[model samples]
Target chain A: MKLLTYFFQWLMSLLWVVALQAQAQPTQPYSYPPSEVVRIHSKILNEERKVYVHCPKVDSADGNKRFPVVYVLDGDNHFELLAQYIDYLSRPDVLAIPKIIVIGISNTKRTRDLTPTNSLLNYEGKPDSSSYQGSGGNEHFLQFMATELMPMIDKNYKTAPYKIFAGHSFGGLSSLNCLLTHPDLFDAYIAVSPSLWWDKEYLLKMTDEKLKHGSALNKMLFFSDGNEGGRNSFFHKSLVKLEATLAKKKLKRLDYRYKHYPTETHMTEPVVAYFDALRFIFKDWEKQR
Target chain B: MKLLTYFFQWLMSLLWVVALQAQAQPTQPYSYPPSEVVRIHSKILNEERKVYVHCPKVDSADGNKRFPVVYVLDGDNHFELLAQYIDYLSRPDVLAIPKIIVIGISNTKRTRDLTPTNSLLNYEGKPDSSSYQGSGGNEHFLQFMATELMPMIDKNYKTAPYKIFAGHSFGGLSSLNCLLTHPDLFDAYIAVSPSLWWDKEYLLKMTDEKLKHGSALNKMLFFSDGNEGGRNSFFHKSLVKLEATLAKKKLKRLDYRYKHYPTETHMTEPVVAYFDALRFIFKDWEKQR
Candidate 1:
């Protein structure tokens, strides 16, 4: 019985080796392309943050090419999606968008970094202390991005000058805050259903006050909202006000578009909204090509 | 000199052990949850296939719940994109789509398996033997999917009855072919920019012949064409003909919609088309919920 057990164990080990060999051999059906997860320490945020970077297939043709970077907020939620989009849209045959690097900044404290002002007001104009704790860190977050994260990414990867900042909901508010305060940080901005009701529409007031009439801003902005409370809701009203504010400014070289998706929800809007935002920002890119 | 060499070797082995230990330990800066690459052998196609599966964050709330499967063709091109989309759209809060299993079938002789008929005709009605060499294996490919791939998937993964068949270009042609021939294979079919010019508009004829007037087919079909050519092109004509044929049939239970994206190219269409297709197919689903 002891001899039989030893023989069976040996046969099992042999089968394991055979299976490993089979896995190593390249078959037409099975190809495991390597995708790595990178982690870096951020001094400004005082926390070691992780960013998911999905680079394009680097063949001989694209050896020395530099890619534009897309820094997406809510990294854990939308990083993979944006990475996949960049990979597919930048294929040689499908050159709608350029090959781009995606830097997804995952969150530790959601309310601490993405909000502009640390207020306890909820969407309904009521005080919600628990939800709004540690808010108003948008400026600090942007500083961390510009000073710490961006520098680290630039030092590590092949990147271009053109950058895009994207976010949704609270992240959406962060995107707009960056656009308003640090317009030079990104070439384009995408805010899907931004929490404009934050601190009683603070961002809207800032947008109205920031731009001088007929100023040459030279930036691209894409913002949209979904059916938060049907067509005639306060969420839609705030979006309308923002659009009106932008229209009133008539800033030169400031390319902007506002889209309304009545059929999509606040959460579901990001998927279509982000795609449209890309399309809107790059509407003239294909024409130039 | 012999003692120094032994010390150097010992130091190297210690460093290797530390590196391996670092990789195994999930630390704060290195919290990379490794994704799995699953491979299954197909008996009918006589080929082994690989699938990249990223399941949701498995917590105590959802322990043994099964997921719906989304089988996308042209896996090499669009698997990661669909995987990311599925991940984002099926989040706990998002819940636009259900938690689903994604089976991306990578191409093996794409022209052979995606084209409908054995013909050497190009888009302009001219004979293009070089391009059409290994055409007309779609039926056999579908058989491989049904008899081999589907069973293997069912046996291995936790799958629900609901399945989606998606494809682009020639793969789109295969998707439509599967819909007409084997309607029971998938609940929803998405054909983005299908090669309608294949074998003298073979699938168009098949659509006209197979679907009876006022018949209850009980299927959902979403087909669209981007700007393959300008407005007065054969690609657009074929899509128009398909719509007309479907309209003439007047199938009571068949829910279908044809979308024309004049702004998008053959390559750029899928990004937006797929999103629109999903929304259209599930437009009423949300209301029901």
Candidate 2:
């Protein structure tokens, strides 16, 4: 009887301790919509490339439905922000945009893969050798993406034909490079604070060269610059020049929007710029739906 | 010898199948900064309430650093976004705002807790009994937050003295209600598109009565309205009236901002409003830091 009493006491004490622990420590991690970190072997790059992908939650109604893909550069910096925006925008209540499969391509040798020229000349036309060494591999990088990454993603995910190419800074430079060099690669493009000053206005010159006057380039483009180097700075001037060049083109079907966030800093611009870009890209999405 | 040969062949085929499966499958879930879902037993509300808490990642430098807490309503809709925003804004590279804790208070009987009054009248002043039944428990809800939720949170977490209260729509109404009734409860308040037409603008009248004219109300208030109900909307009118009332008071030490997102829809307004509010609230954060 005494042993039985002791056992009950012991059990009661154990339960009490558990209750205290529960009170002290909140249980369970807050659940976020699930996303995956995917790795695919790229033969063109000759190395494994990692990408962050976030797909919409599939329900019974969307059993066989496919989604558009938003392939963003600088995955580590901007992937989650894009994913969060997409999720919120596509919520049943919000419905600002359709559900999307976000593909965030993280970098390997950022300058090398993102820059269009092998020149060591910096934004200021100074030969910053250490920074610009082995800088011209963007063509090869895009080739790897076109031949390897896209095919792998298309094969594995429930993807529609529509795709968006998005990037910031050097990544932004690469985005414009991709669009000009291979216009058919993506249906839409977003370049937030592109380093247009790269290699003595290489992209700005390329923009003027590649795009034709009165020609049709059917795609949605969102290009933006913040108060990066200020109003009179070359960075801002380069953006203005790019805008003027595009205006000069008068392309027949190129739906593009250029936003100047005078209030936002360069690092902070992507947050608002990405949101504005998505909204611009899908301005008539609801009406169409 | 024949049995050994058969086993070797079987092993080789199994290895090949494994390799194929590995190629097909992309392993691992994308990691997000961790957040906790805390279920605290609430005596005031007489129910177990669940709140989502996200703290900044503490490092060796922050061995015992306490952080400010932001208590936001509509947890299910906005918690993760706030968490994502705080995390990004406080990043070393993008130090727009200081690192802070985010607490997302989800709803249980939202109308009961968020509305300032029990009237069944809709925004159009028609009785909407079914939609608004069991309304006007906001005072009790605030009581629950102040006496129960905040105390419990303060006890469990490493919290600083400062706190921010944020909400949208009806939740926005509740936020304004809290600011007026319990000004000491939080250091700052954010109301994103507050439903000012509630109970024939009960809180708007309260705003006039509660705040003393030309008196010091040393707090940060951010209130905004989207293009809700359109240009000539009563909703927009009410917001304008609220702004006018505050202007009329000319209250001392009241740091406030009123934003009108003419391009944003009622639903889509919160995303930009919340971001803008955070930026507004911490506009001089970098300078101070």
Off by more than 4 A, model 1: A1-43, B1-59
lDDT of 2 by residue, B223-271 (tens): 9999887879999999999999999999998899999999888988888
Docking class of 1: acceptable
lDDT, model 2, position B25: 72
Candidate 1: give the clashing pairs.
none
Q: List, residue by residue over A1-289, the lDDT tens digit for candidate 2.
A: 5655675688899999999987776568878889999888888878898999899988888979999999999999999999999999998888989999999988988988998889898777887889889998999999988989999889989999999999999989989999999999999999999999988898888899888899998999999999987899998999889889999999988999899999889888899999999999999887698
- Docking verdict class for candidate 2: acceptable
TM per candidate, chain B: 0.88, 0.91
lDDT (Cα atoms) of all candidates against the true structure: 0.83, 0.91
In the order shown, what is each candidate's alpha-carbon RMSD? Answer: 4.6, 5.7
